[model samples]
Target chain A: MSEMTGWLLVWPILLPVLASALAVVAWGRERTQTLIGFAGLLAQFVAALALFVQVWAQGPLAMSMGGWAAPFGIALAADTLGAGLTLIATLVALAIAVYAWADSTPEQRSGGLFPLVLALMTGVAGAFLTSDIFNLYVWFEVTLISSFGLIVLGGRREQIDGAVKYAVLNLLATTLLLIAIGLLYGLTGTLNMADLAAKVAQLPPGAALESIALLFLVSLGMKAALFPLYFWLPAAYHTPLPAVSALFAALLTKVGVYALIRVFTTVFPEGFALTREAMAWAAAATMLLGALGALAEVDLRRLVSYTVVSGVGVMVAGLAIGSEAALLAAIFYIVHSIIISAALFMAAGLVVRSAGSADIEQLSGLYKGVPWLAVAFLLAGLSLAGVPPLAGFWPKVYLVQAGLDAGAHMLVVAVLLSGFLLLLTVGRSFALVFWREAESAATPASPAPGASAALAGGGRHLRYALGALVLLTLLLGLYAAPVVEVALRAASELRAPGPYFDAVLGTAELRP
Target chain B: MEPLIAIVVGALFAISVFLLLSGSLIRLVMGLFVLSNATHLLIFVAGRLTRENPPLIAEGMKVAEAGIANPLPQALILTAIVISFSLFAFVLVLTYRAHRSLHTVDTEAMRVAEPAPRAARLRGRDV
Candidate 1:
C-alpha cells in the first residue's frame, strides 16, 4: 500500500513526459497534434485530480525515483499545497491547448509547438512535485529551456528580441540558483529538500548561510519577476502569441512564488522573519509600480502584462504575512490570478485579432461586432479589478483580511490602492474598445476572413472557457470554507518540518 | 591541490563577473559560460575532493565497508553541465537573432525593449 501510494506521487511527472514524447513524434500532423495535446492534457488533469484526492484521503504522498531513497536519489512528494498547484497548472495547460488549437494557423500548429508546450507542462509539474532541491533546480531549467523555445517559436522580430532578454535574465537566475544549491549541499550534506529542511539550521549561522539564502531569494525573486527583477517580464510576455503569453503569464511566475513559499516556510523558517518583512515592502512597491506602469501603457497586451506584476505583489504579500490565514489567501490569490490573467490575455488577443491592433487608441467599438468576446473580457477584467461576485474579489478580500490579521496596515493600503489602479487601467481599456465608436470611416464592416472566422469560433470558446473558470472562481469565493481548510492543513504541514525530514532521511536521528 | 582548484574557480568567477559587467553582448555570453563552469566546479568541490576511489561497491561488499567519494554531487554536476551547455548554445542563437534584428552587438544599444514605456501605454496603438 505504501509503495502504491509512493508511485501515485510520480504520476504527475510521468504524464507530461510521455505526452511530450508522443507530441514530438506526431509533429506536423494537426489531427495527431491536437489529439495528443488534448489527450495528454486530459490525462494530466485526471492524474492531478486523482493525486489531490489521494492526498486528501491519505496524508502526503512520497516517492523515490528508481527505488532509490532521498539525499542520494531524486524524490517526488505531493502535499496539499503541491496538489493544489498541480491542479491549477494542469487545468491552465488544458485550457491553453484548447485555445491554441482554436487560434493557431496550420503552419503555426505544424511547427512542433504542441510538443514544446507539453514539455513545459511536464517541467512545471516536475518542479512542483520534486522533493530534492537539486531536482527542483533541474526542473526549473527544463521549464526555462522549454519556455525559451516556445517564446521564440513564432520567429517574429519583437519575439526574438524579447526571447533574448528573457533567456539571458533567466539564465543568470539559474546560475545563481545553482551556486546557492551547491553552497547549501556543502553545508547540509544533503540534496533532498526534506533533509535540508531538517539539517539547515543545525549548521552554525554565519556569512555562508546568509549569502546562500540571499542568493536563493534573489534567484527565485528574479524568476517570480518581483519588484526590481521584474523588468524582463512585461516586454517578454507581450511579444508571444496570445495563448503562449497567457500560459507564461499564468504559470511561470506562480512557479517561482510556489518555490518561495515552500522554501521560506519549510527550509529557512528560522532566519526569514526579517526577510519576510522586507519581502512585504517589496510586494508593496511592486504593486504600486506595476499599477502605475499599467496606467501608462497604451497597448492592451503590454497593459495586461503589467497587471501580472500588480497581481504578483498581492500574492507575495500574502506569503510575506506568514500566517495560516495569509497562506490560505496566497493560495487562493494564486489560483485566481492564473485564471483571470489567462482569460484577460486571451481577450486581448481576440481584440488584437479583430481590431487589427493591440493598441486601444486604434481599437474601438468591438462590443457591437463581438459581444460575447466583449462580455468575456468584461467579466475577466472586472474579476481582475476585484469586483464583487466574481472570482477575483474573494482572493483580495482574503488577502486584505490576512494583512489586517497580521497587523500589516501598509500592505492593506497597498492592496486597496492597487485594486483601484487596476480598475482604472482595465476600465479605460474596456471603455476604449467596447464603448467608443470606431474611429476610421474606412474601417471594414467586418474583420478579415481569417480573423473573423477565428473571432466567431473563438468568441464561443472564450466564453465557454471564461464561464468555466468564472464558475470555479465563484465557487472558490462563495464557499471558500473548504479551500481555506485545505490551505490551513497545508500550512500546518509546512510549519512542522518533522514529517518532511522523516520522509527524506528515513530513520536518521535529527540533530536539532 | 583541492585548495588550488578552489582558487582557480574563484579567479574564473571574478573574470566572469568582470566580463558580465562589460558593455559587450559577446562578452556577456562568454561571462555566462564562465560562470556556469564556475558553478560546476563549486558542485565538484561540494562533493568533497576525495581521490580514493569510485563510490561503487565491489561484489559481496557491504555498503558501509566501501570508502568512496560521494557520487551524488558528481551526478548533479553532470546534469548541470548538460543543462548549461544547452543554455549556452541557445543564448548564442538568441544573441545572433537579437543582433540581426536590432543591428547591434553592444548590450547598451539593445535596450529598445524596455518595460516602462510599454507598461504606461495609455495611448493605445497597434502592438
Candidate 2:
C-alpha cells in the first residue's frame, strides 16, 4: 500500500476528533452545530468508504505513529473487517444524526449532544482502527466517557438513575479490561497486536495464557452485554433520547464484539479450549435471556434494547464456533444488527411520538393512525426476526450451517431457537401495538402534551432518514452476495494473520 | 519483592470487590477507586520490579542498554491512572447527582429507570 493509502486509515479517527472539537467550538448555536455534525459524519463516511475500498482492493493496511516501528511504537491497522465496520458505523452515525435533528428536544441539543456524539464516534473509529492493545484500552475509555455524557445528557431522574448503573458497571468492565491488558503485556513484554501474535504463538500452551484469555472473554463479554452482564444495557439504553439510543444500539456493543474477535483471532489464534467452551455457553445464555427479556418488556425502546442483546449473542456464537465461515456469518450479522437496531429504535421513537405513549398496552390503532410508520416498524421488525429475504436471515442461515459443519449442534439449536423467540417477541409487540384496537380509555404513559405536534414538525426529515436506513437494509438483503463475499474474505484474512502482520510490521516473513 | 506486592494487589482486589458488593453507592465509587489503584500497582509490579537507571539511550546509541529499567509498564500505569482518575471523578459526580435526584444511595432503592412491576412490588402488601 502507498503511504497516501496508509493515511486513509488515520482519517477515520482524525475526522471525528476534528469535527468534535469544531462542534464544541460551535456549541450553543444549534443550527451551526447541527451542520457540523452532519458534515463531520458525511466526511467520516467518505473516509470509511475510501478505507474500505482500499483494504478491499489491496489487502490489509497499517501505519505506525511518529515513525516508530511496530512492537515499539503504536500502530493503527485496518483489515477488511475493521474497515467495513468503520464504514457501517459512520453510515449509522450519519443516519442517527438526522434523526437527532428531528426527534431530539431542544434540551437534549443544548446538552452538548453534537459534540458528545462526535466524540463518541471518534472513540469508536479509534477503537476499530487501533492495533495496539493499550491504545485499544484508551479508545475504550474515550468511548466510555463520551457515552457517559450522552447517557446523562437530559438529566431526567431516569437518566440519572440509569447513568449510575451504566457508569459503575462499565467502569468495572473497563478496569477489568485494563487488568487483562496489563497481564498480557507482562506475559509477552509487547503491546502491539501484530508483535504479540508472534510472541504468544511462541509461548507454550499453559494455564497462564488460557487464564488471560478467560479474563479477556469475561471483560469483553461484559462490554458486549452478554446475558448476566447485560443488565446495564436495557436499564440505561431506554433512558436517552431516541437518536442517542439508536446510536448506542448500533455502535457501542459492536466495538466490544470487534475487540473480542480481534483479540481471539490475531493475538491468541490457537488453543484455549476452555475459554471457547465458556464463550459457547455465554453466547447461548445471552441469546435466550435477551429474547426472554424482550418478551417481558412493554416499553418499545427497552424491548428493542433486548433484541440488541440477542443480536450480540448471535455474533458471539459465531466467534465461539471458531471457523472462518462462522466468523463471516458473525460479521454479516454485525452489519445487519447495526442497521436494523437503529431502524427499530428510531421507528419506536416515532411510534411513541404518534401515539403519545411507549407502553404497548396503551398503544393501538397505529395501523390507521400512522400507516407509514407501521410499515417501517413492520419491515424493520421482520428483518430483525430473521425473516427470509431480509438482511438478518442470511447470517443466521450461514451461522447455522457453520455450526453444523463444526459439529456444534447445541449452538445451532440456540441460534435457531433465539430467532424463533425473537420472531414471537416482535410478532406479539406488533400485534399489541399496531394491530389490536385500544380496549380501555386509560393511558399509562400519556406522551408529554404536544409531543405529536413536535413530531409533526420534524416528521418528514425523520421519515426520510429512517426510510433510507430501511431501504439500505432491504438492498443489503437483496444484494447479499457481494457483501457476503467481502465478509468471507475478511474472515479468511483473520484466520491467516500473515498479511496483517506484513501490513502492520512491514515485514514479509513474519508468520505465526 | 514481586511476591509481596502481588499479595498486596490480591488483598486490595478482595477489599474492593467487597465494597463493590456493598449496596451503598458511595462505597461502590470508593471500591472503584481502590480497584483502579490496585490495577495500576499490578501493572507496576507486573513489569518485574527492578532497581536500575532510567531507560535513556546515550549519545549515538540506538537503544537503551540491557541493565536499564524497563519503562513501558510505568508508562502504561501512568496512562491507566490518568484515564481511571477522570472516570472516577465522573462516576463520583454521577453518584452524587443520582443521590440528590432519587433521594437514595442504595442501588436497590434507585429503581426509577427499571421500576419493579407494580404487581410484583404490591404483592402481599395491604393497599
Candidate 3:
C-alpha cells in the first residue's frame, strides 16, 4: 500500500481525537461544541469512506504507529471488515450528533456531551482499526470510560442508578478482558494479532489454549450482551437520555461483537470446536431470550434495547457457524442492526417526547398526531423485525440459507422464531402506542404541547437525522447486491487472513 | 517467585469477586479496584519476572544484552495502571453521586431505573 493510503488508516481515529480536544476547549459554549462535533465527525466520515474505498479497491491496509516494525510496535490495520464498519460507525455518529443537537437539553450539552461523543467515536474507530491485541484492550477501555461519562451526563436519580449497574458490570468485564489478554500474551510471547495468529496455530490443541479462548469468549460475551449476561444492558440503557441511549444502542455492543469476530477469525482461526459450540448455544439462547425480553417490556426505549440484544445474538450465530456465507451474513446483519437500532431508538425518543411518556399504555393515538414519525417508527421497526424488502431481511435470508447448508437446524429455528417474536413486539407496540385512541377522554388526540414546541424549535433536525438513517436502510435493502458482494469479500478475508498478515507483518511467508 | 505472585493474584481476584457480590456500592467500587490491581499483577507475573539489568542497550551495541529484564510488560502494566486508576476514580465519584441522589448505597434499593412493574392494572385497556 502507498504511504498516503496508510495515512488514511490514521485519519478516522485522529480526526475524532482532535475534535474531542477542541470540544473540551470549547466547553460551556454549546453552539461551538456542536459545530466542532459536526466538523470532526464529517472529516472522520470522509476518512473512513476513503479508507473503505482504498481497501475495497486494493486490499487490506496496515501501518505501524511509529517507524517500528510489526510484532514489536502497535499495528493499525483495516481490511474490508474494519474499514466497512468504521465507515458505518462514522455515519451513525454523525446522525446521532445531529439528533443530539436537536434532542439534548442545554444542561446535558454543557455537561460535556460533545467531547464525550467524540471520545466515543475515537475509541470505536480505534477499536475497529487496531490489529494489536493489547491496543484493542486499551481502546475498549476508552470506549468504556467515555460511555460512563455519557451515561451519567445529567446525573439524574435514574441515570445514576443505571450508571451504577452499567459501570460495575462493564468494569468487571474489561478487567476480565485484561486477565484474558495477559494469559494470551504469556502463552504466545507476542501481542500483535498477526504474530499471535502464527504462534497460536503452532501451539498444540490443549486445555491451556482452549481456556484462554474461553476467557475471551466469556468476557466479550458479556460486552456483547449475550444470553445470561445481558442484564446490565436492559437495566441501564433506558435510563439515559433518549439521544444518549441511541448512541449507545448504535455503536457500543457492536464493538464487542466486532472484537469477537476479529479475535476468533484472525488470532485463533482453528481448533476451538468446544468454544465455538458454546458460542452457538449462547447465540441461540440470546436470540430467544432477547426477543422474549422485548416482548415483556412496557417501556418503548427498553423494548428497543432488547431488540439490539436479539440482533447481537443473530450476528453471533453467524460467527458460530464459521462459514464464508455465514460470516458474510453476520457482517451484513451488523451493518443493518447498527443503523436500524439507532433509527428505532430515535423514533422511540420522538414518541416518548410527543406523548410525554414511555409506557405503551399511557401512549396512544400518535398515528393521527405525527404521521411521519409513526411511519419512520414502522419503517425502522419492520426492518428490525426482518420484514420483506428491508435491510434486515437479506441477512436473515442468507443466514438461514447458510445455516441450512451447514445443517445447523436449531440455529435456523431460533433465527426464524426470534424474527417472528420481534415482529409481534413491534406490531403490538405500534398498535398500542399509535393506532389506538387515548383511554382518557380529557386528553386530546394531538402531539403534546411540549413536543410540538420542541418540534417547532429544533425537532425538524431530529426528523432529518432519523430520516437519513431510515432512508439508508431502505436503499440498502433495495440495493443489497453490492453490499452482499462486499460482505462476501470481507468474509473471505477473515477466513484466509493471508493478506492481513502480509499487510501487518510485511511478509506472508514468514509464517511456517 | 512467579508461582508465589500468581497465588497472590489469585487471592486478590477471589477477594475482589467476594466484595463485588456485596449489595453495597462502596464494596463494589473497592472490589473493582482490587480486581484491577489483580489484573495488573497477573500481567506482570505473566511476563516472566526477571532479576536482571535494565533493558537499555550499552553504547555501540545494537540490541540489549542477554539477561536484561523485558521492558514490554512493564510498559503494558504502566498503561493499565493509569487507565484502571482513572476509571476507579470515576466509578468512586459516580457511586458517591448515586448515593447522594438515590439516598441509598444498597443496590437493592437503587431501583429507580427499573422499578418493579406496576401490577398489570392497564392490561384490559384498549389504549
Per-model TM against the reference: 0.92, 0.96, 0.97
> Which regions of candidate 3 are displaced past 4 Å?
A441-451, A507-512, B56-66
lDDT of 1 by residue, A230-329 (tens): 9889868988888899899989999998998887777788655557667888889889899998987878898999999998898889878877778777
Cα displacement (angstroms), candidate 1, residue A319, comes to: 1.8
Question: What's the distance in Å from true for residue A283, model 1?
Answer: 1.5
Give the distance in Å from residue A134's predicted Cα in candidate 1 to where it truly belongs.
0.4
**Model 2 CA deviation exceeding 4 Å by range:** A443-454, A507-512, B57-66, B118-127
- Among the candidates, what TM-score does chain A have in each? 0.94, 0.97, 0.97
Kindly indicate the candidate among 1 and 3 with the higher lDDT. Answer: 3
Task: Tell me how far candidate 1 lies from the true structure as C-alpha RMSD in angstroms.
Answer: 3.7
Q: What class would a CAPRI assessor give candidate 2's docking? A: medium
- Give native contacts recovered, as a fraction, per prediction: 0.64, 0.90, 0.88
Candidate 2 or 1, higher TM-score: 2
Per TM-score, what order, best first? Answer: 3, 2, 1
Please compute and give the TM-score of the first chain of candidate 3 against the native first chain.
0.97
Q: Give model 1's docking category.
A: acceptable
Please provide, for model 3 over A400-471, each residue's C-alpha lDDT reduced to its tens digit, 9 standing for 90 to 100.
999999999999999999999999999999998888875556345345444566466788999999999999
